[model samples]
Target: MARELTTLVTGGKFYEGPRWHDGQWWVSDFYRRSVFTVTTDGVETHQFDVDEQPSGMGWLPDGSLVVVSMKDRHLVRRAPDGTVGHYADLSSVAGGHVNDMVVDDRGRVYVGNFGFDLMGGAPMGPADLARVDPDGTITVVAEGLHFPNGSVITPDGSTLIVAETTGAGFVAFTITDDGSLVDRRVWASMGDVPDTTDVMEALGSGLPAPDGCTLDAEGHIWFADAVGARVARVAPGGEIVESVPMPDGLGAFACQLGGEDGRTLLICAAPDFFEHSRSVADEAVLLTMQVDVPHAGRP
Candidate 1:
């Protein structure tokens, strides 16, 4: 079914890590080096600045905010009183720039990285997924993942599904009682992905490069097809049940389902993912569309 998307806001420099929290839509603007919260009617307010560039975000049980500082490979915590401080540093374990993350109900944070110097044109390689306990202890839970970008924990908090951008599918891991990941398996296989390190070649292999995503109540995942210029809803067996195309010349990069009823699908889009171009232009935007199934599970 075709759904119309409304432009919620504009003039961003590559928005990522979109989330719905505390009755507002929060997102990180890469080149802008700041995080902003937007109202349903498109009013934007700068929440905080991350000098190293911010990516993912989540909240603790006490209402404190944890944000991923990309370049420095650190997690910054913002207390309810507005004081910001370092929560944990992953530089010692992260192979590259740490990116998106998901903080579970227990305040355990699971984050991923680039695994290589992506912007520097280095060869693509596997990276590890790190888990940060509530006490701020970091551990490499899983290793050798193909660029884990966005992730989601099941409503029961028993499973974690992560988007493997270059792997062309979603990988699932059983979350143990102590916040460990086990029973690794493929949740969705998009296509026969080529075993190549070239980003363009991997993207052009006719497989969906799933980026940031959110899970719906019906057990379907809505992910941004990074190079496909659309957001696609995938079933467990790798079936694309629905897809929403982006506006002309733009590509959807990340998405989240939120709003009063959790039916609102917020999308982050830009002309391309090139850092050079996006860092210099304000072509990024936030788009919204209403869907039938409401969101379920963690961010």
Candidate 2:
């Protein structure tokens, strides 16, 4: 049995990027273009606007914040002076808006995107993966994906597993020293869940493809299953082991384990869509749960 986390934030249009920083979990509100910091007791210190669709966020070695603006197709770095600068332009390789991402231990950033006009009616090419090295050079790692959304790197930095949100599965790839991918294989499949289409399927029925994720000390992946409204823990063998529950019964977008103790499961959840237009219930929210396992990063 799993514990159902209560709502930490309600009536949010959309939420993504649950990251631990500055003594709080800083998250991006995708549809609202705002960033929020939530304390442990569910008190939000602030919700500041960033003026762009920020999907993912990272921290530089020097203590600056790096943000991924999807529609802008730019990697932004929030300087020590709190000014945002364009760190890299990824529009050439990314067909459309960038989505979720994972920054590896060595400072390489792997970005995923909505390649073919997923919900915006502005169709593009097949989905692709972009890699930005420490020198700010952008490289295309993989392409022809259905919908590359959430991702996480292995603890050892030798593997990066990405979620193909629309294709109904996840792909594990071998990460090269230069931040390229080879030996790509299906790490996990959605296993034919109902109400899920082949492409970026609808949510709210507990069946949409996965979106955001993080790992535990045991190397188990706790991925946000969009429509499922649950953060499912996937074992190293790629099996769904323990599922942490949600409040809205909607899409649990992305998740990460962070905090001083590194045992808190922070989740970004929102309502789902069918064909990107039809909506079920507005169950969008942010939730958290205390788990027994420590986070992979801290381990």
Candidate 3:
């Protein structure tokens, strides 16, 4: 099947998270320090200066906007009254920055941090993942993960599947009653990575790094590649069933399946390597295409 790219909100800043909310798509442009809303027609990008690099996004039961402040190492909640409050100070647990997150229906946010700084071009990450409680308490849910990036929960909320970005794979954990991970194991491994990047030029090697991911109603896991420029759909058995080719042939960062019917696939891409330029999406847009299934685990 073929998919078409539609530009929704271009030429403002670096856009990352694209989430469907309140009848429109809300996204964060990290470099520009703004949050925006784009109509489904891919036109009219409105900016909200957030004063921080907001990456991932989610909503609370009370309809507050939960944004990840990467530079400040904090999770911020934007209340309906227009006040932004600190939900969690992740600096004590986050080694680098708070990148992306997945919030369950119960309002629990699971966030990931950069284990090591890669902007200097090095394979130094094995970032850890942490859970932020509703009461704003933070705890390390799992450790020794190689750059846990985008994540999703099962339809029943029984398991949390996470993408190991720098590690080139994914893992799953049984969520206990208390919100801790149990029975941790690799959900998927892309393959072994070799040293070749600029970081490898310094530290001597590179990693494949699967970045962001989502799931389908049938339990298929879909992931975006950092350098691969492809989105892969994997079956529950940990086998890749189909691969969606990205046209740009560059770093495709993240993706989510959304639409009125939940069949339109949305892609968030950086025109080039993000670490080097630290730029935003001028055409960082919302690309759409109809699919055969609806998104699973909170799109």
Candidate 4:
């Protein structure tokens, strides 16, 4: 079925980590260094600010908020009274700027990083995924990942799927009781990741850099392709069942399924990822489209 895309919010600088929780759409503006929530009609309220910039976010069973402090590579926790404090430090575990994260039902967090100075033009390298326990202990769960970005834990809490952006696939890991990731394997194969040095040449190859994603009731994942300017709904076997392209010149960086029945695909769109351009310009916008399947997984 054809879906209609609408702009739900605008005037942000590089939005990421769109999540549906407690009856609202929460997201982080990377360059703006703030996290906020928006309503279906476009009303928005500021949540909190992160000095090092904010990315992924989730809540604990006790109703506290956990947000990723990207530059500093730390998890900041927000209490019920709105006091924000350091939850866990990743500087020792993360080798570069931390990107996205997913928290399980038990408040265990899985984090990803750039592995190299991406914006500084350093050559891409392998990164490791870290697990942060609720009690603030950190462990490297998986390694040799090629730019692991958005991730999601299965509804049953037995498996974790991470988007390997530069690897052109999604990798799955078995989660154990001790919060360790094992049995690593490729869950989906999209295409070959470009090996060219030119950024545009790599992106123009049509091979997608899969970013933030959300799982649906049918166990299908809808993920944003950073370079393709589109969001694709892919089955477990890597078949793209649906692809929704953004308008001309705009790129989709992340997405989430939420709103009422959990069928709304909230997309984060922007023109570029360069820090200077995005931080100085208000080009980021939150768009929404209605899908057929409702969301059915952990945040």
| Tens digit of per-residue lDDT, candidate 1, span 1-299 | 98999999999999999999989999999999998999999999998999999999999989999999999999999999999999999998898899999999999999999898888988888999999999878999999998999999999999999999999999999999999999999999999889888877888888899999999999999999998999999999799999899999999999999999999999999999999999999999999999999999998
Query: How many pairs collide in each candidate, listed in order?
Result: 0, 2, 10, 0
Candidate 4 residue runs with Cα over 4 Å from true position: 195-204
lDDT for model 1: 0.95
Clashing pairs in 4: none
**For residues 1-299, could you state the per-residue lDDT of candidate 3 as single tens digits?**
66566555446445676677776777777777878877788665654565768888888888888889998888888898878777888988887878889888778899998776666444565667889888877889999877778888988988998887766778899988889999999888666655433434422233345666778998887777776666778776457777776666345677777778777777776665564365623545445556787888864
lDDT (CA) per prediction = 0.95, 0.74, 0.74, 0.89
The candidate that wins on lDDT is 1
User: Which of candidates 1 and 4 is the stronger one according to lDDT?
Assistant: 1
Model 4, 174-279: lDDT tens per residue?
9998888889998888987777644446556778788999898888889999988899998887899999889898999999999989989999999977898999
Best first by TM-score, ranked: 1, 4, 3, 2
Clashing pairs in 1: none
Best candidate according to TM-score: 1
Report the C-alpha lDDT of model 2 over 1-299, residue by residue, as the tens digit.
75757667766667788887767888887766777788877776545565767878877667667778877788888778877678888888887788888888777888888886656655434688988888988888898876787787778888888877665568889988877899998888766534433243233324446778887788777888776667888775457878765654466778888889888888877656333322233445778788888887511
Which residue runs of candidate 1 sit more than 4 Å off their true CA positions? none
